[model samples]
Target: MMDFPLKPVDHRVLLPVMMILNGVSLATAINLVVSLDPEDKITSKRGSALTLLGFIYFMSLSEILNMTALYTGLGHRYRNKFRLNSGDVLDITNKFVSAVQAAFSCVTGAIVCLWSCTRDFMRTSHYMSEAYAWFGAAYFFYDIWSMYIVHLKMYSKRRPFKNGSTLLSSGDGASVKKPDTSFLAYCKHEPVILMHHLFIGGFGFLVIVYLRGDLGDCTFGFVYLMELSTPFVSARGILSRLKLKSSRLYLINGLLMLATFFVCRVISLPYVCYLYSKVIGSSYIDAVKSLPTGCKISISILLLPQLYWFYLMCSGALKMLLPSSAALSAGDAKRRS
Candidate 1:
């Protein structure tokens, strides 16, 4: 969608104007959808048609945002300001887009979660959740394509080739890429992420449209709120790619990332279970034990990966904040000497 190559005589004048114009339209559309009367729009027979409109609305917005970023000097100006190579610029561009998408998803998730929680945590249904599911599903499709572009570009860039090295060298001594950078390669390298996206976009979409039956919007809302931590993840990627790991902002963001991931992605699931326990007037342990086998398996599947990721995050944070073990041992040896 970002194919605009014609920069106006002075794009600085045009950029903000374009962004505001698009932003207003996007906001207006969201407000309209959010304000829909569930009885009139959702419970009615035309509910399906309205949601189709919602899906197209968001997909169009994604395209427009991409074009805005391309033509508004958003990505190009950043490249000029930072003096980063073109090879890394696309990654930065995608990160900017990813951050924006994550922000929107987080906001919509918050809206759904709040509205549903205030009613009833599990059984009560809300139009907001119903509406935003289309957008969330659209994003999963868009993001998968965006990420594949990143991987393709990264692997296509010149990589070093040495004797007994992973990379191969062209006959003229120029470096070449190792392994295929095809879609299959991307799928092979990222099975977990692929499954996660498919599970949410496919299975979650099933829940929203077919299986939910006006109940469990609260559960779906909680699922949407899982994106709460995603903006931090995107920011961390952008900062790391810019070689800003030692900066104060990076450290602060890392802290926030870990905290948000723990709260939004990890603890949020258990919190839902606790809420369920309270709803059923049962003890937490008993409530958990009372869950169906399928439910227990699903929760475990989600929670285990989160726990593993949290451990890795903590390890990375310690490695960044504290002295390395090698450095500590060297210091102790010097003192002894």
Candidate 2:
């Protein structure tokens, strides 16, 4: 009999779940994008909304890639079991390549951010507006590159058969050795870790976008800084799991809540800023009105890299958190039996 049953509720189940989430996010983004009033020059409110919507789109796309990766990764693990001809070796290779590409894209994003910041700083106040425009453009290009890399990785992992036979083949001309399916089984039952990471990464990217002035007019750099701290918070949870201790889970949860608070606050800052500026004086209103329509286009263009990063982090977090519960339970039952 097969040692590891091919259960229906394996990692494969996550694909549809992620797909549904992606659909929802996509719809939200499209709605937000369509709602923009063309008559109004792009204000901070519009820019912020666009940035959030763009990030949502990026998240959706990343989740799709992540689902594909998880499917292939789990499939490779399964093939390793029962000495079957698992065509997952290539998939694994593709995933690694994808990781490398993602890293490169991140580096590129960082560079672009630095360059824009530098240019803006060098320019006088007269050029401040133009500087912001340039930064937005840079961000957009960076995001496109990052998104393309993600798509490439997902596409590369599609063909599993080629890798399964060539790389996963056992040396003895027998089927490959089965892996301890328990690992994947364990993953399904404990998906919180993944979710936490996703939230942090997604929020972190938003913070970065906000920093680049691509999101809104609010100078909420502090909030962005707070959101950026999420990875460290999640790292604590990972450490707890590795050490087999639940002592830090509460602390991690606290941090997650704090991060969520910041995310919401930061997202809402545009409206807050608008209200504040309106109350301050007509000067602010005139200044906002003076911004060219191209500024909005620039911000949208530049915010893409940050959006991609946010999506990557969110997708990675989800992958880490949600494990295949059925697979885990089956393994446990088999071991106990």
Candidate 3:
């Protein structure tokens, strides 16, 4: 068992999971590469295979490193100098892991999107698109599993933190601890986080499964755009963990978050949907309708949370920018006096 949020996780479980995902990802890549048509020159096939294989290898290795950092608490040093409670430490670590994932997503997702966009869909290379989608599927599968594990711990029946001691010592020779409470109490402030994770993860898996071949390049471009706001989300987390809520950095990040959320998630997704609709609505497609309505509906439904979240993010930012309730109340008291 892992220690109270701060202790090392059970490597037995962790290592095996990483190994399995890596093995499966690599195997899939190899299979796809090997299945290339015989008509192509052997030399060209070899070059293409090696390129795809290299990407798969890099993606796997990057995942391994990311997971390792999270499980091992590799960057706890940055949390030093601040007196964080156990709850704060846990929250910060959670966000830190998210930041790492977001960073990866922004990088690789951008690459995938750029690569896809450079190719004309009518002339899109099927093998290249499959390679990207397959690799993305593997990564998101692992990500969702990891998120579910964390969600279970957070939402479990019992309190998830260490008992007997309110303080957990960090590597920086400082001890910080906070009182633990039940999940219901914990989620009172931000109840949507878990649901957001579940929905996003669910749809991501769906895209991997059913739409990988049909809509790989298009969906991927749309998907990667959603990650544009994630880095800002992660930054907000880091600032919150360090108790920098009143700082300018937090304020700036919040504004950036709103802009990116609107541009990337709120706007970009619907644009992709519009393009999808345009394709399906065209005169040529009227002769034979192959695109399913349900898939379109599902993709549209994914935008619902984005709208809600953007609202919340904007509201929060405005609230922060405005006078505090306490401040307003204090002024009222002074005027009355």
Candidate 4:
């Protein structure tokens, strides 16, 4: 397990920061619900608003779990158990798992966003839209915060390794082993990997744009594309840096996330078309009615990917920062000769 640099003050500050952010999300959700027009009673807009509320609540809950795991040192246990050795198998398995997790997070976010947007489209209410926008913003902020913590933990772990004896041999009879890779190394090419996710998202957005006559459909498509692609892009960048060969367990996880993304996109097409019809001034309001089913299926498919990706990200970060105590044993010292 990796050692963390968290002081008492750090915990105190982080707790309040998380709380304030989550509280704002909750308040925004409530405001959206409360501000709904009385005349729009029991419409799709109400459903969408409610869905947004549920998602925000869940996101807050997830963040709390993450914080607890990080602060209480449970995160250390998880990392210790799962951290990959340098010679681990390179397989497609982890990639698949990551892909699945990415897909799941996207699906989950999409459903919540879609539900809110659908409700608004049905009645032209801005409450759902506002709530949806706020939810996305809140999520982005939380993700950034979490990523920072993960980075800090990684660096703290790396310090010991950096100060330890060399692992490799050089021509001068000195050790030449490079320090284990850092999490940043694993994620350095993230921007490049994110391009694929962006492309997919752009495709979704363009499809929605074509259906502009049905504002509801357009909204759903836009949110779905945004929600689904953002995490995948982010994860892709992270995965790219890890250099988990196609055969590694983590690679398989990533592939699963990717597969989920593909599946979710396929499932969403019909709904997209329906929304498009509505957008083009077609009286086919019922086109969007079938969207809930697809959305639900997508949500279910996305669950595994989300859990796995989170696990990998946490574990990988720790591995990059902290070398196992065993790596510095007398035997290892002798091996350097």
Candidate 5:
């Protein structure tokens, strides 16, 4: 949906534009922090402000680091993981930026989850902590959109995945390879990511407006779970870039990712369903009925996608755990013969 315009452009334009957008995002974050009212009752006051500031600052720093790494290849020194040749600079940078964003998001989410669970556990309906979550979501919306656009442009060029071949290269000369696939195949895989961003962005906006930065602690808890698997996801990317996917570390990280996704996203869905139902049953009019149509829809829409994503996660976990299933079957057939 975001790629409506298929016009061609010089790849040279992308780098500067991306940098400017990142700068704009940084400016927006600073503005929000500067405009924050210390005496505001809608927030946890100093705590919320500090959290928001930290998140924004970290995000800005990530953006700057991404720009510098992409432009100057400064990231190559970080164990020399990335391969930034003339042919794949933009694509590689996009992946690097996303990995960084995901890592930071995971950290921020962990902090929010801990803070909310510990300090404001009892306050489940209306309180100030929601603001912090909302603020983070707002930043995430822009971040997702920006990356989506960059990748969309980068993926615009067609490739032949069907005729693709993989080679084994070793020693210090090893480099990461981009997947060989048509734009359509890329499109097919990307919607889930784009949709996730869209939903979260919309949900965040609604939370800011109708909920007024207060979903109580309970609802906010489930929402925060969305980021629980992010660090593992990011780690997998970093490891892949470093060409460690076949190592024990990659396997361990993959296992952790699977477990975290199951615990955070899969298990939390049913629990949230139960909790939301209970809330509606307790005060139907005040909680459910009073909500705007969009807000109600946003909350309801979160469950189905999450359930589907969990199913995908489970399928992936099975495949990862049983990576030699085909080989085992072949061995069994040979023995029988």
Candidate 6:
């Protein structure tokens, strides 16, 4: 099963889930590109070096942005609501950052992807791709760090510390010293999401930026748009926290989330494949058959998780959208049994 960190999410952490995911992704992307052979046309060793610097700079900046949002007003307001536990402060911060990122990504994607035409989707990487791609990468570098903080804080809240003692939980309910609150623990709680970020952060960079021989950067731009649904996802979680589930605004957000998730993520792979087939002058079926096995595998690796999330979303939506059935057969039967 896919575990997503959302409602009843992290309490006190530095950045949001997606921001952490974004930071880690940005750093990984830069490092991956830097390690590649310098024969590539898209980036040079020096350029990669410069981008690394930018990555670090941006990672710090992302935290500042997150902290600014949290410590000032929003965090305090959200934290006080819980009264007993403040761990949710971090979780709220995490969501705020994710929403911000989604907004930035949507704009960035549109500015770059729609600047020209779809013909260049697989054959151009000159302007915006070259200029802003690295900036996008920096976001990942910051987000990975953010994800860890929230996860750790949330873990601490879940298990709690014994005054001055170092007792903690290893995320599996077992007690340990200070807990495993390391990257490994974060990975355990958010494995699928972390992997999704990692794949996009590391390998996706190669395909979108480097492997195209400096072409189709616009396609890379489209990847940003894939995050279009992220804000809604974060918003949904926030509204849930606010206990606004039945509000009309919540309902609207949920519907938009479903639409965007379906359009941007669920069918994104097939749409890409369709575009690829069109580019190659072949039917979609033939194109799929002709694609390298590795490509097919990569697509599957990205697609399946999305489908799983969509399934979970639909199920959750049904529960949320429909009126409660107090006398559910399962509830009655379980009581009787």
Candidate number with greatest TM-score: 1
Per-residue alpha-carbon lDDT of candidate 3 for residues 1-337, written as tens digits (9 for 90 to 100) = 1223323555446656766766775676567656665212223344445445544554455445444544444444444557644344445445554565455556555655565555553223334333444344344444444444444454343333455434445679786664344445545544566455555555654454344454446456567557778878978977987889999899989989989889988988656655555655664344124456766566667778888888888788777887688589899999999
Kindly give the number of clashing pairs for every candidate: 0, 18, 2, 55, 3, 23
TM-score for candidate 4: 0.41
TM for candidate 6 is 0.73
TM-scores for all predictions: 0.78, 0.26, 0.60, 0.41, 0.58, 0.73
Candidate 6, backbone clash total: 23
Q: What are the runs in model 3 whose C-alpha is more than 4 Å off?
A: 4-80, 122-192, 277-291, 324-326, 329-337
Considering every candidate listed, which one attains the maximal lDDT?
1
* Residues 79-175 of candidate 4: C-alpha lDDT, one tens digit per residue: 3455622111111122332343345345535554456445655434333333334333333333333343444444433324456643455678886
Q: How accurate is candidate 1 locally (lDDT)?
A: 0.69
- The residue pairs that clash in candidate 3, if any, are 86-177, 86-178
Cα-based lDDT at residue 256, candidate 4:
54
Which portions of model 1 miss their true places by more than 4 Å?
Answer: 1-32, 38-77, 159-177, 324-326, 329-337
Of the candidates numbered 2 and 6, which has the greater TM-score value?
6
Stronger candidate by lDDT (1 vs 3) = 1
lDDT of 6 by residue, 63-101 (tens): 544454444466456556644243455556567767776
Q: In model 2, which runs have C-alpha deviations exceeding 4 angstroms?
A: 1-129, 158-337
RMSD of each: 5.3, 17.8, 9.0, 13.0, 9.4, 8.2
Please give, for residues 162-183, the per-residue lDDT of candidate 1 as tens digits. 6533566788999666677778
Looking at candidate 2, what is the lDDT of residue 256? 68
lDDT of 4 at 213: 34
